[model samples]
Target chain A: MGQPKQERAVQTRSALVRAAAEVFDEYGYAGAGINRILKRAGLTAGALYFHFGSKEGLAEAVMNAGQDTVEPLLESRGLQRLVDVTLVWAHRLGVDPLLRAGVELSLGHEDFADGAPFESRRELMAGYLREARDLGELREGVDPEVVARFVVGACTGIQLYSRQVDGRASLPQRVKEMWDCLLPGIAAPGTAQDFDTGVARGERLGRMGAQA
Target chain B: MGQPKQERAVQTRSALVRAAAEVFDEYGYAGAGINRILKRAGLTAGALYFHFGSKEGLAEAVMNAGQDTVEPLLESRGLQRLVDVTLVWAHRLGVDPLLRAGVELSLGHEDFADGAPFESRRELMAGYLREARDLGELREGVDPEVVARFVVGACTGIQLYSRQVDGRASLPQRVKEMWDCLLPGIAAPGTAQDFDTGVARGERLGRMGAQA
Candidate 1:
């Protein structure tokens, strides 16, 4: 009975964090009221306080949760992996209502006195770039750290613009364009030709499959 | 006397808008109260209301004002200009207490019934891409609209990341990387070689000038 109660408490905390993420994304941190968060979670002030000491604490938890979700996606992919994961995640994180809540949490920490959660993501990207270089995927004379930051920066730009605008540009198309522009610079000299050829072949195969 | 009063009123309205922009950026839209904006502008409700009918009205004015400021810069430089101007504008927009406030007002309008103000900026970029295509600056088989959106998207990403984190990657460096990646894909074939040569010559000329 006690174990079930503890599990329920954990579930409640998770629900609260998730609710808080949505509210924060929609209304921003300073604009979001604790009462609203508690109300949405269907919990009392005590439960809220127990899980997160204050609003700032809640904001941090939301960000931590988001980082937990995205960090692993970053680690598993190669350079191409980053593009694939981002395209999948962008739909969820950049477009889907539930996941889009994480965007607010990430942007809201701009006012934090300590440091923002994005720092960890940036470091993770830089580390991945270093690994990619060691694996000889990156071009000669390319600074892995610089390229990492650039890649991350480009992804950030796609998400921000996609979220703000109406039905002007599709997210997937935007991602493809960014990747196309970006690959030529960081790619080992002839690698771009190979990738382009593969993309063309893949399109042809897909077309033939669709016809059949 | 009436003309001078109108002029003074214009100046006062401008001052109030500037002050509101600062407050909105720092505290965000919902968090920023009309009283705070008035206090910052050294004015009262009557004065503010005289210029702008309501808080929403004031936000519109701020967005319109920002568009006026930003459009000319874009027009003069063309869409392909490097991130220098964009970065300068972003740093100002992010850090300036006044401009930051305006940014929040602009961003918060996502929920507004009408629409956000920066919509035209996207159109402007798309138009620039079309013009670039006619001029043979863009590569064959590339979608100019997609490329334009991609460039803008990349810029937004760099701005958001640079502002959120403290790191060795300066805004300019990140912008440069984005351009370096983008130009190769979009530039006319062999244009990358021309760019590299131009950069080399520019550096040599600078060194010779310094020695002389």
Candidate 2:
């Protein structure tokens, strides 16, 4: 209840979350064990029980924390913001254990409703797309919801292939190319050239994430 | 070998493969155990060893046989054929245990080289896109390989989401919607109206798959 004890508790919880993320990422939800997570964290069972209470609780914590890996792009808007979110997220996925573990856990465990932020992320992107359509940035008759779903779906696939093929070294480039192929379909006529899908801006954003 | 003995051997191998598919589907590649598979099949270890040699070998067998679930669309060509391939595969994904097991094993085991037919499937789809381009189907400057990769990736994501959300009942409709969003980006101007992203054709093709 004291200040120093509260800080220590925070640090312990953080360490447990990190350890759980690593184990879950490596072994998946079914294969991950509580003892292994504790060993990795170098913490006592009492500490884990005090903090997370169970493996399922720890998984929820990881998934909740995963969204924090990529900071919001308050400066960007419309389709540009959507593109930035994915590019920056791709970069972070290469380095962040908690984010990757969150993705793996949500993807591997089909029944867990609060698993990943896929639906929430989809809604967020769809909101931006709606704004884009209102501003005459989107092609006529192009549904924002459909584009949002396709973009999210494409991102999931691109990450999987990039990870399998090259440890995601080419993730930024692949994400950029995905936009290149898709922009024409979603963007208003002759406006596809107005946007930039380059990885440079996203790379800078990712650096900001690291600093934060 | 006598005819009856050879028949019995074939049946034993088939049973082992089916049982392995069930276990791999439920437990994934790492959680799947040889004992569990044997128990499911009501067979002995000798039968498994004689057929698959090891767990890795059984996994390879599952991946190889997974491709056999859908019959090739020899009558269709170009992007239409590509669409047909995905639609039929999506339908089969909901019904076939072997195909779903192969996908789970390949997706879960990142190190397995022969995991899924993703790379091969990409190459195949790219070839069709090339033909489509020559026939004046694709947009100017659109890359076949890029579209191919995106399509494969989108299909993977769609299947995962469909399975998680609706037990894959909506897979056909979702696959069709993916094409609806993508076709405008890939098709030549004015040619976009020529294609059908409907689930009806795919459902018919799925019936053919079942009959085959």
TM-score of chain A of each: 0.78, 0.90
Off by over 4 Å in 2: A1-4, A26-42, A69-71, A110-116, B1-11, B26-43, B68-71, B110-116
Q: A136 in model 1: Cα distance from truth in Å? A: 3.1
Task: Give one digit per residue, the lDDT tens place, for model 2 in B3-41.
Answer: 798899988888888888988988877789999999999
Q: Which candidate number maximizes TM-score?
A: 2
DockQ of each: 0.43, 0.55
Which 10-residue span in candidate 1 chain B carries the lowest summed lDDT?
A: B197-206
Whole-model lDDT, model 2 = 0.81
Q: What TM-score number comes out for model 2?
A: 0.90
- Cα displacement (Å) at residue A113, model 1: 7.7
